[model samples]
Target: MGQKGKKIFGISWNVFVLGLVSFLNDMSSEMINPVIPKYLTDVLRTGELLGGTLMGAIESLSSLFKVAFGYISDRFRNRKVFIFAGYALSTFAKGALAFTRYWWDFLSLRVLDRVGKGIRTAPRDALIAESSEEGKTGKSFGFHRMMDTLGAVAGPLAGIGLLYLMRGIEIERAYRYLFLATTIPGLLSLFLILFLLKEGGQEVRKKISGVSALKSRNLRLFLLVIAVGALGRYSYAFTLWKAGELGYSLEGEMAFYALFNLMYALSAYPIGVYSDRVGKKRLITVGFLISALASLAFAYARGPGTLVLAFLLYGVSIAIEDTAPRAYMADLAKDFEKGTVIGAYHTVFGIFVFPASVIAGWLWQSYSLTYSFLYAAVMNLLAFVMMFWIRDKN
Candidate 1:
């Protein structure tokens, strides 16, 4: 059996280190995430549509830099530096979030936060890929993703808990305190990376353009399909927005949001492990179909019970989508420039996010919520149809 099969108390060393980093970092990000929509509308007075649009815009804009950082990491043949810098930058950005009093400040700081993610994501995934034992890629990446989702699970719970603790304080001021406290875990993640993460000796491969890295016909067509699907896959902030739309109290909505992350965390590793046996392409097609159903569920759900099912479906969709796609990409890309290929994928997908958000916001404001969600369902269904043509033998 591979080292991937031999986990030391359920996690291999390198995957454990990276997973710890993600856990702390996600705890920090998720704390504020559950409350951000309400924060923008209630505190900053940005209103609903603009709040959703801004969230998407910042994510898309910040993610645009991932391709460059990815190429830079490949050119240097050093992943650790970018990883450290990305975490460090985000830590500082998290610290700065509390001082913001305006919408632009929110946008600016949020984008700065994503800057760290943009810089780190591709290189970090490359590290996970490099660290994996042969024939164990699915388990390795899946384990890392599981760790990441674990952080997502804890972050929202911590956020809501903190809010409960500061119950007597003004709500806006309490939000600031939450932002300030998030820095500790964020800093810890960066601190641990300095010790826990290390890179292997460099191989002297010719540097390639990020775009040129997608020489495989499968990768190109795969990316095109993903980008098209991304048009309906707006940010998760919309999920919270939808919860609030359903008349859940802020606290109730936060809990519901946390439930989704919890499900995502639980399912990520198992799905990854299974994909290793079944082949990733078949699982990915199934996930797209699930997402289509989830979208429809979110659209029509009238009560908390129905919404719970919707959120769980969303969680299952996310877990499968997030894990299987990476495994498939790892399967397809050349070892020499996998970081660049992943970066290109993140970049194009992120670029599409801006317009998707805009379209969603427009539809949301101009039309009914039912239409807004059904539109997403329709796009996902189209992707489900297109997934059949992926040319995979599975």
Candidate 2:
């Protein structure tokens, strides 16, 4: 490896290992993602209104807990334990899906899985940042994202395969098979977390407490920007729903999802490297605009061509949002409580996502899917305006 590559690769091994853990976890998680909403509506005979509500509740509740767990991890200066516990929780949640016959049971397990995500996400990202050098933060995060996306790619593929294998079976049985198969990857992720990733070397520095960190003017503004951006962004479930409306088969929809992940994975590193050179704030602004455009396309699209373009733009937007915001958090955070700060940032951002999703779901049901997309597009426009207020020196 050359100097930059060598440096990135050196600390990046931890990221790589963590990526493997994510890969396994995503393989488990994605199996559920494209299927669960359908299962709720089609198999369990739950209505779309209830399904959307459940989705919003699970996502928001999970995000709320991430803030709490992230603070706990930072105060204790031990990230590994939280990570391990989080993975274990997810493993259990995946298994629990097999037994879920009632809507509440399914929703409860979804919340549990999200709880694990909320706990692990901040500390895990903090670890990636701490393991890397300042200039390489974007690259490090990008690499981690790539690994996460790799799992995203694999998970749905596995789901597609399982669906094919059980093609003749009843829909509920097919979901059960997917749930059981997903557990294998989930448990494997936990095992990797235990054996591969290291913990407990870095000392917690003396700094402002979590509440005080939230008081920082720059961080507060950044959180506001992310919240606005998130409002414009709806869940990917909407994208799949759009594809279905366009007459794409489930397999075809999965292929499009795979295509999106492929682009997202390929773009993450390059975008991260570019952001490091250009400025994270600038990249974030650009990302929001791209997402705004994508939402517009989705809202107005009347045919397959427009849907394809929208999904492509959606993939690129994700590349920017996922990598740049993370790099920005690392830049703004104090060394001692990096995890806590990032957690707070995500927590605040996530708190808004719940309302955004609920509104999006409601709009989709009551008004039109196009209106939901328009709502998200408007949020992105507002986020674009807010970018002018952000100072990027950090």
Each candidate's TM vs. the true structure? 0.94, 0.94
lDDT of 2 by residue, 157-275 (tens): 88898899899998788888788788898888888888877763444435434345566787788898888887776778788877877788878888778777877888888888888
Per-residue error at 165 for model 2, in Å?
Answer: 1.4
Candidate 2 lDDT score relative to the true structure: 0.81
lDDT of 1 by residue, 1-394 (tens): 3324435556666577898999999999888888888888899998657876897897787669877887788778888899999999988888788999999988889889889899998888777776676666788777888888889989989988899999999999999998898898998998888986766333314445344548767777777777777776867777777888888888988898889999998888989889888988888888878888888988899988889998999999989888887777766666677777778878887898788777777778888666667887887788788887778653
Per-residue error (Å), model 2, residue 275: 1.5
> Residue 390 error for model 2, in Å?
1.5
User: How high is the CA lDDT of each candidate model?
Assistant: 0.81, 0.81
Q: Which ten residues in a row are the worst by lDDT in model 1?
A: 200-209
In candidate 2, how many clashes are counted? 0
Question: For model 1, what is the error of residue 105's alpha carbon versus the real structure, in angstroms, after optimal superposition?
Answer: 1.1
Task: Check candidate 1 and list the clashing pairs.
Answer: none
